[model samples]
Target: MSLTKDGPTPPPATARRGFLDVRDLVVHFFTDDGVVNAVDGLSFSVEPGRTLGIVGESGSGKSVTSLSIMGLNRGRGTKISGEIWLEGQELISASTEEIRALRGSKMAMIFQDPLSAMHPFFSIGAQISEAYRVHNDVSKKAARVRTIELLDRVGIPSPNTRVDDYPHQFSGGMRQRAMIAMALSCDPRLLIADEPTTALDVTVQAQILDLLRDLQKEFNSAIVLITHDLGVIAEATDEVLVMYAGRGVEYGPVKELFAAPEHPYTWGLLQSMTRLDRKDQDRLRPVLGSPPSLIHVPSGCPFHPRCPYDAQAAPASREIRPNLIETTPGHQVACHLEPAERQRIFREEVSPGL
Candidate 1:
């Protein structure tokens, strides 16, 4: 269950690569203000039995990307384009019926807030039973038995009794576990967990992460873990995708990215994390400046306005957007800084501080 120190490449491009492949995905919201480009040409792949963490500040399109992949943006004033290939099947152009058929059976999502995601009126057991029945043609009694089994498997105490409790009856951690149970009821090949550990105590968060890793190993499911927590990524994910202004600014293996992040935005995030290893440090640093507006992102790189090196950055950094170019065999970044400058800063300055 240990994550790799080196960034592992998805199966080669010549190969089909993975169970889920997202290519040049663009998602735009037509608000009265203007077109808010929530996700602009983002792309990534998730192999079965591996976890990919998508980290970013609020409104960086991390949630939007997951929603787009889940097809949850369809009726939410969002226009989605680009390819979403799941297990050799093209999902973007698939019919609504097709997507619906696949959603709970082949793919499922564990939303951030379990209280909101679950139905207050129904018992947790009833909800889980319904989910199981949707993709399966089992009798109601059989579905209820399956639900109880799932509750027990996810470590819910007194599964036979607690399964009958409502969402409000469970603690935050328990509710989150219930959601995971419901998501796994169908035995999906892909599972997208959006901030699964948010609002939980650190101890509970660690437990939840361990549970997910164990379940991933059992099911061999490709996981898309969306969160702003670096600790969670460091603990569980095989790969990291750092998003800024609706685009991926840095992507690579979690260990490699942490050891030598190439983007300034990534440097900011590392500096911002509260380090339990550095008890001698007096205070934690935070990324300077607010996140950019999606409606009117910066002219060039969206991070230029807050970048410490902006004044001295190359002229094109202020005029043109940077492409996500690979720096190593598996690591890649989208930044205007020259490779030499990025290396110098990470080695001489940023690495020591973090």
Candidate 2:
């Protein structure tokens, strides 16, 4: 019993450091039409053992942000600027080989679609072992053994046999689990899950979320969960960042953000979700107007075009850009509307409806 007394202790709740920091992240693609701003001046951070959810509609730069962090945007006629510091290491400045080494060992991503992300031609064991071998100087037999352990850790039944099966041999949920196992194989400190629950059945979705939660506690990994599902964001994240066009419109604690969202774009996202909490609520009413084209994004606030509060907003929303300003401690919103007015609208109109 005395031997257990000296176990490592997690920092006090107030004494956490930013384990992953991304500042002014800008990712642009050169296209026939023009340069498309996939991510525009985005900045956020996640601490070890915490989850930060990046939520938005399709093309809101959620996946692009994750890809940029992983350096998957390299050599694609893409221009990426900004500093992605993972555990104080400047990733943007790191050499290609340096980043490649860190890809699985320090940072890993669970992609949205494992079917497409995994190699169908190879067996799961080979793929997993190859990933392990890339960062470890282990024999193939040792790698295969480690791969089976990972499969077992991620809850695969009869993992020894499943390890030899191809990607197509695994079901949708199994594939998703395998993806998680691969991401965890190297015990990465940072895990980026881009729509980890996409295209799964409702039950399987819940299972995946639970799996991530359990694994996160075990590994104490900093996670950036990218998803359009607000429900998943609410249940999974410690903080939330709402992206519009390509920029962050709202960022704050999940509870406070969900209860008192300041940005109009965030309001639309919340109002549109089909909440089982309110059975009598009518059918879902999605945000009006499609997301603006990134190449032709509106001047000033990118959300101003579809913004219901545009008429009520100040000149900034119409003619000048609004910077991300902190209205409350750790709560930031980039909107031209005055903080008091935004609060009043959410409190009087938005909060009551949903």
* Residue 70 error, candidate 2, Å: 0.5
Taking the tens digit of each residue's C-alpha lDDT, what string does model 2 give over 1-354? 000010123223343336787777889999999989998888788988999999999999999999889988888689998767788787888888989889989999998888999999999989989989989999999999999999999999999999999999999999999999988889999999999998788899999999999999999999999999998999999999899888888888999898789999999998899878866746666789999899988998888888888989846787877777788878889898999999999999888778
lDDT of each: 0.88, 0.87
User: TM-scores of all models?
Assistant: 0.94, 0.93
lDDT of 2 at 256: 87
Clashes of each: 0, 0
Query: How would you encode candidate 1's per-residue C-alpha lDDT over 176-239 as one tens digit per residue?
Result: 9999999999999999999999878889999999999999999999999999999999999999
For candidate 1, the C-alpha RMSD (Å) to the true structure equals 3.7
Worst 10-residue stretch by lDDT in candidate 1?
Answer: 1-10
